[model samples]
Target: MSTAAVVRYWLACDFHRERRIRAVLSSFHTAGGQLQPGIVDHLAGRRINQIKPSQPNKPYSAAEWERLAQACNTMIKSANTDHRRAVEASERGMESSDASLSEERLAWIIRSSGPLAIRSLMELFPTATVETHQLVVSLRRSLFPDQDVAFAYNLLFAIRTGIVPDGIDALLTGDVTRTGPSSILLSYMKGRTGKESLVLSRAAVRVLDQWLEHSALLRGHAGDQGSQLWLGTNQRTKEGGRTIFTTPRTQYRRRVWAQRAGLIDDDGGRLQIHGGRVRATFHHLKDRSAWTGRTTIDPNHSAKVEADHYLSSHTPAQKDAIEGIIEDAQTDIRRKAAPPLVTNERDAAKFAQQFPNLVQEAELDLPAVQKLLDAEQDVFVAACASPMKSPYAPVGKLCPARPWVCLLCPLAVFTARHLPNLLGLKEYFSAQAAQLPLPQFMGVFGPYAARLDEEILPRFSTWEIAAAAGNHQTLPLTLEEQGCY
Candidate 1:
């Protein structure tokens, strides 16, 4: 639809509650037809009943949601005023038949002088929320107190589930059922494409029950055993009679709330809360559940659509969360693998200098003279003096191989001074291996541990082994306590 038509539809529909002429007329306005019945009929002669696809909505940030909720409070305050209620009542034709609820009335106002002027204002801002004690004591309640509970629930449900305004109108009493823990069944699905049943969260179920109770108290009927869960009174209809409350009015009030909240974006896309909320819900699910490769919030969506579009558009935080999961998995694998070995002082010094971040040094001395040493809890092991490049070291970078891989490499050299670190490495790997997946445990830890136990330990002297055992019991614990764990 053209932008003008979209703007006109909300303006015209917001004022009238007629189901017959206004319903078709509202469709014409949204579909870009002239306000005149003859012109609208001419434009939609053949394709009168065709449904148009909705525009994609952008998701709101956490700040935007908070602002929207706050705005709802502001609107409630303004809605209670004599002037505001008069305007709202006139718009709904609750005033005397002689009273004017036309552009002329709005023209006298400051912000909106006419229909076009109000439309322009709305094009810039959209309103969207609720109050404590489960009610909004505003002009709406003053004018239509019977519908207050139902109206509040409509906004609450939409904010929570991202359901379209029209979808909410389709909801029935039978749709709500307690199926299981943390699950409330929603049976009256929105459209043909909607899920047969939706399992609502426990929190949602609690609110739903409250709304039902409020409805029963006000209307003097049990909402739990009725045809419609949402029942509200209205002042105007095409027939100039009372009508059932619907989404169009709810939508208009929400926009007013949003505009007051100052949550509307510059582009005016969020003026319509449904699409924006739906997008936000989708993004939240993607961030939380994408790693399992089964992130589906709205059950109506196909897997292909979810994977192709939603998963590919992860926010920066979502990307970081996914990477964190992968890192955890990789760490688990390395823990099960074998521990590295330093058989002599030369190798120990070389490994220490090559991987300074991994090895804690007591002093910064030249590697050529090999004076730097790895400090234990209260002792220092003299550095190894190996001459050749580490066999497992990566090109132009520190070693990427796991510690256990260092034990199996032929280039490895070690001595008594290296005993403490070597024992700690073995202990760390043995503890991690148990937590890793079986494939990673077998592939990395089993073979490396065997090599460290067999070939490397035999080369160490009795005194050196004793020192390593002592360092293993104390040195690693010291590093952990110092926040280097």
Candidate 2:
């Protein structure tokens, strides 16, 4: 057996493991000097597809997402209020001396001096009353949260920006720059995509500003340690009891915050708040079809990744709407692929015999088909069998389709009489192709021009085409059509 066959047999039931093993072997092959063909070479054209898990980490439901957002917002708001009160009390002549210890006094001390003043306050009043010590500890906990208050700010920012967790964690003070009055340019590093930047929305800017204010006191005390945009306190230290200036790292602390906030998922269990899930929820709730007339949601990501990871995962209603759009596109493709119903003869003598399926499909009898061939139902270019029953317009109204639209319309019939107009349309298409860009010309007139040149005109005899070409003139056209030339 080949190397690929042997590897496949060895890991037949564990495709995920097989993919990892293959990746390792591929890396080894590259590191080595390619001494032999090896396993990676044998598995080159084949894909070891892993089975998707039945219950993947799907985007959170709307209710769960809203709860998460509200919880984060509440925590941030409370921190902001506490920070504001502390600043205000400090300005009102509250002192950190041993005169009398109160919450406002402790707040003033922490605000004036750094968080380190809490230790000094305890030392200054060793035999102080129980209420004084309690007040000092409570004030410290409120101002510099030991549980990493940065989590709330970081989660809220991620929820709004849809940035990956690594990008958020790697952010520094210098990464945030004010680009406009209401917007900020945030630069961060992503492991996979390297350095990236985004112009934050007004809402995101507000959240970031609140966080900066909330952590401003600690940052001033921290100096070099506060460079990392997020700062909290580490209460687990045995020496100083609670050390200030920390970053959000552990998931356990975030879970504690979630529990404190009383957040619950759809299953009524404790909400598992992770940065990845938060980012996914942000994208899931965003309008994927909305064009901002600028850049994409995440320009660093490829279209395949965007579709596979985010766009493909949607609620039932979204899936239904997307399916409807896909069905319409498929129907249009099938209609365009159908050959144009053009005939050289001017009468319906052989219309039924030549195109019996079309005749039956349109439910056209001999007299109705004859009327189409005799130009009685003539439009600008072709004779429409039933103008009132056109698919391009309302059922009871005339088709307001463009002249070239008849080339692909199922209800249209072409005969020798339309040759002069058809030749004129071909010239019009040529002029359009010259003026418009390649992609635009291909998108707008490619199908119609292709049908006319390759299908409709080819059915006519060379002598008949020559005769029609001689009679071809500047045909009467609408303002829209005349403007194109």
Candidate 3:
């Protein structure tokens, strides 16, 4: 069959919801003529129609089974190749970085199942609780399935076993460099392609233990800077720490670590210990006493996306927001935008320091690039934000009770087409939620701190976070003694 035909057959597998499948594939109008129509996750042979009506497509004959297997393999291989191509394209976009998410690793993620996948996940996560486990599994299904389903499953397995598989940190960094095939764990399984690597690690078990005990080190920041750039997800490592992470989900973990570390101040402001990205955490730190870092959490996250039905902040606005985000970092990313320095981080940093400031001094403070990021966020916030409410509706605020239209939106099209991507977005949304308004659950919990009235930050405030280490002390916020969000 043609590539287009193969794509259509692949979609008609029995595992999919018919309505959902249609919604997802609706955009691929080109495939209409070439494909079979059915649910997803089915592997079938040529003349697959002979299978039971309700069952997944089947291999009618022995020869057909082999053909089906070949098709499945081909389909999977094509996805892996496509993913690598995407990765390569991204690398080229980023100036041709030498690394790529290798094929061996992608294969491992897709084919492996059971506890073996769990063992591989532990190196990055110490202990995967039920919630975390469910999260990992969901993320696995949503991650690049054609590429890293097992890798995702391994992450889920780690959660179940409380193991932290090695290289998980790399995954968080969007790195998919696969380690070589395993030997020790799978020695017992005969046919020995020696591919059965578990997702957890001995070190991860220890980390999980430490994490559970809240024993891992937690540092507070005393100051932070974030006036000209978006607070990056990964803060600089303390001294020689090997892992650097900034994905919204990792930021949540960092915030949890901070809470355990006792880093956030009495008020919602994050403390900068020496000069790390504590300020980075502040981007999402809405409440005092919990600078849990910025995240794009699930559920309401699309509210930002859904809000797109509301407004467009424009490119200039985007550029300004990025400018503020960068100013806080005062990095040279901006200078890199010019054709001359566009590819160099150092040059980027230099330009970040120079151009915008020059523009500010010259009084044309509304620089173009700053507006770009602002526009981006505004576009996103608007697009993703929910139009769940309207003046036409009858409610105090937009009722959260209305049905969400996630199933049919353009965003949903991708979510349905790629479960792992949806899962990633869910995790990202969850992380953002971790930083949102912590409800009292109807007078069940105490406030993180008293309300801030003496000091009303009319708008967002930026403080300079010098490069210190971790563990900064927080200034107490004396509220009206009465509490509020």
Q: Pick the candidate with the highest TM-score.
A: 2
The alpha-carbon RMSD values of the candidates against the true structure, listed in the order shown, are 22.3, 14.4, 36.3
Please, what is the whole-model Cα lDDT of each candidate in the order they appear?
0.50, 0.77, 0.30
For each candidate in turn, the TM-score is 0.33, 0.51, 0.13
Number of the top-ranking candidate, with lDDT as the measure: 2
Q: Encode model 2's per-residue lDDT on 1-485: one tens digit a residue.
A: 36756565646657677677667767876787352455655557575566676653568889998898898888777877766765776655363454555556667765666665455657765766888877766666666655446888888888889998888987899999997778899999988989999999888999898888788777887877788888887654455565664557467877788889898988889988877777777777686536545544588876677778887789999999999999978978887788888776655758779888778877889998888877789987888878888778778897888888999988778888889889998988998999999999999999899999999999988887898885665666778766864
Q: Please identify which of the two predictions, 2 or 3, would achieve the higher TM-score against the true structure.
A: 2
Q: Which residue pairs show collisions in model 2?
A: none
Q: Write the per-residue lDDT of candidate 1 for residues 1-485, one digit (tens) a residue.
A: 45456345544552333234446766868988656554455444432233456765666665665555455434434433433444454454433344332332322231122112222323332331222111122232333323333454565565556555556677877677877754687875656576566677565676576565444422333233246667664422334343444333355655654554456654555545554464466457547654655657677787888787877999999999999999867755664342443434444456555655334322233443243233221122223223123334433444444444556543333456557766886776676576777777777567767766776677777776875684643332454523522
Ranking of all candidate structures by their lDDT, best first? 2, 1, 3
Better of 1 and 3 by TM-score: 1
Candidate 1 weakest ten by summed lDDT = 128-137
Off by over 4 Å in 3: 1-61, 96-143, 146-485
